[model samples]
Target: MSDAPKAANPTGADPEANQPGLGDLRVIVANHLKRRLPGRSTMREDVAAGMSIAVGNVPDGMANGFLVGVNPIHGLYATIMGPIVGGALSSTQLMVITTTAAASLTASQPLADMPVEARTGALFVMVVLAGLFQLLFAVLGLARLTRFVSYSVTTGFLTGIAVLLILSQLPTIAGYPVLGANRVMQTLDLMVHIQEVNPAALGLAVMTIALARWLPRTPLRGFGRLVAIIIPSLIVALFHIDGVQLVRDLGEIGRSMPTPDMPSMLRLAPGVLTGALSIAAVVT
Candidate 1:
């Protein structure tokens, strides 16, 4: 039987058993929880803000999942969990931690080659791996590297992502799924088949965009996006609009929360590993 006390690292940054200290993540969270609670007025504002964020994310989350080539429910689930986890660990105060179109686009690339049935499981694995990579970056304190990245490179990267996202959505907006080797080729194919565009779907998409832009100027600004989703959905149902795809069209959204599943070890190969690293880089 060993009687010697375990060695304690002075930094207490790691989760090792012997190194419990103020720097421990658990301690930090506990301290945060014990801090002065917000006053009633502040709490009311927080609740209102949270509700607004939830309403706004309903469509955005599903859209992200759709972009990832998986069931939209998964994205909705991410919207639910991502904020809880992100808020817990987040170091910054200015940003809202949630999914983004760029990261979704980056995630889609890896799943593009996967079968429909397999993509969901593969996505789960990829996400877990990406989280690990991001954690590694934090542990290594590599955030300082971003300071050295050139302004031109950052600007170009963002512009490229935005342009690609816009091009990628053209097919959906046109109610045509133009299949090609990549987004650029698909966009070209979509351009070539301009006559095949569904006027009904295009009209609705335009109206939705207009609503998104116009609503933000009024008192209903905070609810604009949420209303945009609901309004188009009601019209789609009432008119029985065909050709345009939807989140529900991709897969079933269950009535209850899904059972948590283990990430598929089969998907941990080099290709997926690279995809995970790509997602991590884009997300960070």
Candidate 2:
């Protein structure tokens, strides 16, 4: 044997210098503590910001259900769990993992042809599939595909959503029966029936919108939108706007943490795969 000791493999073939895998990544994170305090401080801030965002998301999730024409309870479910999974698997931090209006609208389209029970089932299948597609993209290292969802297209989609959202709620605002299948016709119906509009409900909706618009600029700015909404809601409660057929009431606000559930592979296989493919295309 030579007098010189053998050199270890620098390319990481030696067991002692093995390259990191997914499990090794965790070990590296654990063992390689940064020397600088600023790194630790940055990590702490990230954790804090994440928690604050999570707390803010719950009510907003339920609000999205109102936008999507689904049960608010399911909206909360999707918001909470969707973020937890998508956030973990994501390579980038800027992406917000939440229900998109376009996805919600697209998901709602096929359900219109089905019975109520079947529609509910199909929605469950589709959303589950969408989640799986996100997971698949992450696993396959396809994060770059997000670039195709261009800024202008997103802006147009959001504008369309604003028009649709406002039109959808017109009946609640005007105290009239919601009518028509399309947004234009629904809006037109409200316009044509202007004589029958209820002053109280109209006032309440306008006040809510105005408050949402103006409150942010004032000194008490942080809570302006909340105050605006609460004041109108209180008025609705005190006067019992049911006589005029106003906005739907959210009776209780009980909250809970999300729990894990197994994916129903059988129910989700076919339809879920198709839905996931469609979502992946859109997301890309």
Candidate 3:
């Protein structure tokens, strides 16, 4: 026999040849699941981190849900279920799945036309459809399409989203009703009604914003956002700030855990499709 070792398989074949039919798919699935599983050594740390993230994310999720005109409890539900399901299936340990301002804003547009009572069902459909589209994209290997989007375009898009988020929340922050369907009209309406702004509400908003910004610089930074929201809210309540609205004013928050149910597919309309696509695009 020659001293030299046999040449390696150019096709990356196993030395012990096995059946190629279902074995390849099985290997793929096994590898996927393996990546998703937490290692025994890191289990404690993983659980701690997950708990921290879940708690830290609740306020933002609730805000997004409110902005989307849904019951605030829906936001809490989205935050809880999303991370658990996403964490279990995702390959990356650090990947977080939660409601975002952009997704909520995009979803709100199409939902604007629906009756207040029916908006919740429409929101559910939009979210489900968006998830389905994402799965379709993954199966079709369309992730590479993102490469065609230029960096400048992405920056501008994100900047626009940030502006929209600020504008959308301005009414709430200023203690006024969201005046118009479009941002331009809303801005104009806000300007026209500038004198009607509630002083107490504005002060609370200012205090919350200031604390939220400054608290992170302190030693207790981990709880900055939560404290920022809670302290201002407590002060407002204690002082009995007149003309200031609280979350309790919106509707009764559901106390129980959310259960899964099918969305009303019969209500799907052309506008709903457009909104679903917009949400998926923003999420991606």
- Each model's lDDT comes to 0.80, 0.63, 0.77
Off by over 4 Å in 2: 1-59, 113-119, 134-155, 218-224, 243-279
lDDT digits (tens) for residues 127-209 of candidate 1: 88898999999999986576566668988999999898888788888988798999889999998999999998899889999
Index of the highest-TM-score prediction: 1
Tens-digit per-residue lDDT, 1-284, candidate 3:
77985433323564322433434444444455445445799999977776667666777878888888877778888888887788666654434677788788889888877777778888888888898988888898987687577768988988998898888878877788757778778977988999988788888889989998998688756567778889988897888878888787777787788666776678766788889888887888
TM-score of each predicted structure versus truth:
0.84, 0.64, 0.82
Evaluate candidate 2 by giving its C-alpha RMSD to the native, one decimal. Answer: 10.1
The reply for model 3, stretches above 4 Å from the true place, is 1-44, 267-269
| Candidate 1 local lDDT, residue 137 | 98
Among all windows of 10 consecutive residues in model 1, the one with the lowest summed lDDT is 13-22
**Which residues of candidate 1, in runs, are more than 4 Å off?**
1-35, 267-270
Better of 1 and 3 by TM-score: 1
TM-score of 2: 0.64
Candidate 2, residues 153-227, lDDT tens digits: the string is 878977886777677678777887757787688789889989988888788879888987897588645456666
- Candidate 1 lDDT at 155 equals 82
Q: How many clashes show up in model 1?
A: 0
Q: Which TM-score value belongs to model 3?
A: 0.82
